[model samples]
Target: MTCSYASRARFHRSMTRPFFSKDRISHFDIFEKHAEDALNQVKGRLKEGYPVDFQDMVCRFTLDSATEFLFGKCVGSLSAGLVYPKDSLPGQNREYANHPSNLFARALSEAQSRSMLRSSMGTNWRLAEFWSDRIQKDMEVCHRFIDPILKDALERKRSTKEGEQSTGHAYAEGKGFLEDTLLGHLVNCTEGKADEIVNMLIAGRDSTASTLTFLVYMLSQYSRVLKRLRAEVLSTVGNSRRPTYDDVREMKYMRAVINETLRLYTPVPFNVRTSTEAALWPGVNGGPPIYIPPNTQVPYSVFLMHRRKDLWGPDADIFDPDRFIDERLKYLTSNPFIFLPFNAGPRICLGQQFAYNEASFFLVRLLQTFSSITLAEDIQTRSPECDKGAGRDAQEKVIVKHHLTLYVDEGLWVRMGEASNSDDV
Candidate 1:
């Protein structure tokens, strides 16, 4: 028999599976609608000759949709209509500065930065206590921000127990979701005792947003690729209808672009594995076996592994999505360990498919709405000096930096022009 921890984890996975399943995913049409609302907002601004920071737009879009998927409500970041702050970065635009949601989003960013820094510090991570008091305060803020939703969910569950209408849990129950929605299923599965609400907030928000941010940035830099992608999206999804799960699956090129995006810039660049018990493994170069004592943490860099010259050949560093369609495709089936954006084995992300569905839907909506995106001529690598006029030299290029995930340090600022061939939104 499996141990309690193992069994509990297995049960949790089973409980959560329904929430991210393809069938249940379509029911979350709100994801697509929310994506459209955000995109249209940006498209209107761009039509008026505004160059929007696409990364921040993606962040708000993902935040609103993910929260809606997790809870039954969304923050409506697109509706907040806030501008960039006084000390904002060079390319970033004004953001939605609403209450609760704004504080919640800020807290998420802080906790992720601190968590990344702390993990990188190894055993010295505790030293961050002096610098990371803000993380604690942020968590408190996040909890407070999410508190009312939690209470309402709990009360709804309680009401259902008293034979109240099961609108909250009805769809999930009919479709075999764990509880009703993600929060409901998780709350029910853990007996309403776990501190998982905050965990879900972090898990549901960051990774997907970062992926889309980088993907849009990369798309802007490659017009030929972008043109082809839009063509495929138009042919497959078109102006008349919305894209379904099968429609996205049939989008082979779109799939390739997203795959390449994940390959080149795996959001969570490094993951740490800690051994709970002593272990021995085969040694390298015909040497004797190596020993790994208990409590040892091994860090593997997905960012480096994804771009290995030997694995991907000389053009490993290149941004060619066709590589997925042409060469090296077979190698993935033979050696799956080399590319681990969402990780592998038993701990693979439960939301992986959900993320894919959401992203594909958003891309479909975006390409359908906007014809072309142009990277600003002044775009440059992010730096303290980049904020000044003299710092944006022609030589500067986009650079990747890591915190909880890899993000374009300077931000992806682009100008979107209406598609001449397409009907107006």
Candidate 2:
């Protein structure tokens, strides 16, 4: 356990170093290229008058960008193209569904679901898989796709001797370009452990994709919010040009919308941690302290916490971005723990800023290209019938599915209205 913790800390440090530093502006270019590629595909669907699955497009965008950041070459999931809505005029293309990159994504998602089940079942999870290991089967598919890339990276590493010069373009003065890929950095930090790389891939791909998916879903529901957000995007960055990091930072309303979406639909909604030692919890309203024994498993739900009426006021259940920017923000400012979308403390998400940048960049380009978004409820596969009682979940238009990270059930099928030349600022 100590070794595991130390290894993780070392890996985290490596990631934080030059890769995510403020000066590493090249990453935004990569994000912009992927976002443009994704939006271009969506435009194709729009011209064809076919509804696109926004969730799937964002997933491919993140996957391509994450792979490029990690391996110096993307899996090119975008090349497989945006999938047509189920039973739509184009129908589900067999070749597109069976693309190697798509297969890897499907396998990775399955592996995550199995891992979540194993964690939920604790020590007895193996008992259920005694006859057949489902996760292993899924992982085999993933490995089949990734192993060739790993082999190539390993070969490249072996060719470079000690103190050897790199052939790639240098990003800064005196800093060589070999460390550009996270995989190469991990090779030096953690000896290229496949599992650690996979964990990073999951972190890079799903979390941001989930956030974008929900953000679009929310914008579709509230036209006023969408109009305001698009205005911010157009006014700040214009319609034709790419947005700089500074430009993204300047858009306060856009940030508020992103924050509100994360507050309501955090990608990793539930988390569990084991106590290292006995601890006492402060009671609410001067009540007695609660006892927590050492090594006890503690599971918490940020989803429920972010929605509590007492914490967020009576309109907590409503999808309002104003809570993040208006007077109601005091509730979180006073007690910041009430808003932990990417979590808090030492073990908080290392890629939190990266996720924000990628999401922000993509959203800017998305709103710039598309003037309006309307849900294709007729083609949406998931129904809210399973939700019981009252409140947000009960009245949800799109069903939320939990598989390690939150995702729209079936997919967020939407018809986006393309912006004309006059729509540009």
Candidate 3:
């Protein structure tokens, strides 16, 4: 019973399973079952105008949500409006002081934005180097924070060993992804083992944060899209009950909105790959066969590709979910080679299913709960007044900073009101 509780309680999947499959576990499923628990904990605080950083809230919630599904223990980031302690895995926090997760999140955000701008300018390679150094420093903060948790997981796994089989939960139940991957790798591979665990923590924290931040911003910016999403949520789950994973999966419009948002503002704006060997496009008797030697580094800029006019049409800039309404998905072929939000081909995101399901669940819930959302006054009022530069196009004004992931310079801020606002108005 304790084993079951422990397995179901945390975010990291046990080490016995394949390392890659760890993230495939879905926290949205847990969120659905514990919806009332989360709401009862948070609703009162939200009602009091406690000035919760909604963006941070989403990140923390995703963190806890993902962790619980992977491990069996749920850290109370969302419930207490704080980060899970790096030490005892606090079932709850005694006070609301800023936590490691918050500091880590903020540091990652600043580091990424500064780095992106420096790289984009391309004038000084030295600036890029400096940013890289800062990122490394911030990473130390992350390592110090996650190492203890990983150690705790290892100790727990040790405790559960031997003839506890049959009745015993899998290692994933107790130790989670950290133990599973570390233990497996120790048995198999050599070198840089600790680095992989660090990568997971950094990757998990920022990717979920950036994606949800962009999603919320889009939902706030486009009212019609927001309404359609909310309507779908209401029709499928109704107002009183929480949505199951199946219900979230089946919500077509909500999925479409998410797809569109991802298309426009992917979490990873760019990815780079060096050509392993020479490659070619047939029937192009132009220059040489585009000889990409073995050592050549090729970068794929997802941001530019997603925004290509030839692919998405003139209104590629627009946030229209109807682009995905067709049954055959033909409309999506504006540019056959375009749209690699999660990347395409063999190396696609393994956690894509988990991300979509989680995002869909959260988005639907947010829409169901909130009626009106508008840009905060300062961002809305000052955006037009800011002189981007002498010749900078308004289209180019979309700031893309590379924090842990690409985050807007300022966190996406918006005003949200109860879903009944329309009725009252």
Worst 10 residues of 2 by lDDT: 169-178
Tens-digit per-residue lDDT, 59-92, candidate 2: 9999999998877779899998888876765565
List the candidate numbers ranked by TM-score, top first.
2, 1, 3
Order by lDDT, highest first: 2, 1, 3
Q: How far out, in Å, is residue 301 in model 1?
A: 0.7
C-alpha RMSD between model 1 and the true structure: 5.1
- lDDT (CA) per prediction: 0.72, 0.83, 0.57
Q: Estimate the Cα RMSD of every predicted model relative to the unseen true structure.
A: 5.1, 3.3, 8.9
Give stretches of model 1 more than 4 Å off: 1-11, 82-99, 127-132, 164-179, 281-290, 379-396, 421-425
Evaluate model 3: give its TM-score.
0.71
lDDT of 1 at 418: 67
Question: TM-score per candidate, in order?
Answer: 0.85, 0.91, 0.71
Give the poorly placed runs of model 3, Cα more than 4 Å off: 1-29, 32-53, 70-98, 107-136, 162-194, 280-290, 331-337, 379-400, 420-425
Per-residue alpha-carbon lDDT of model 1 for 1-425, expressed as tens digits? 12555576677678777667667776548776777677777866666555777777788888888777777678666676433322445226434444556677878788889877777777677765865464788778777767777777776656555543535344333233225478777765655643555655566676777788778877887888888898898888776478988898899999889989999888888887777678999987799998988777777789889988788777777788898898668667678887788888997888888878878888888888777777765643454443355322321346667787777665666778766454432
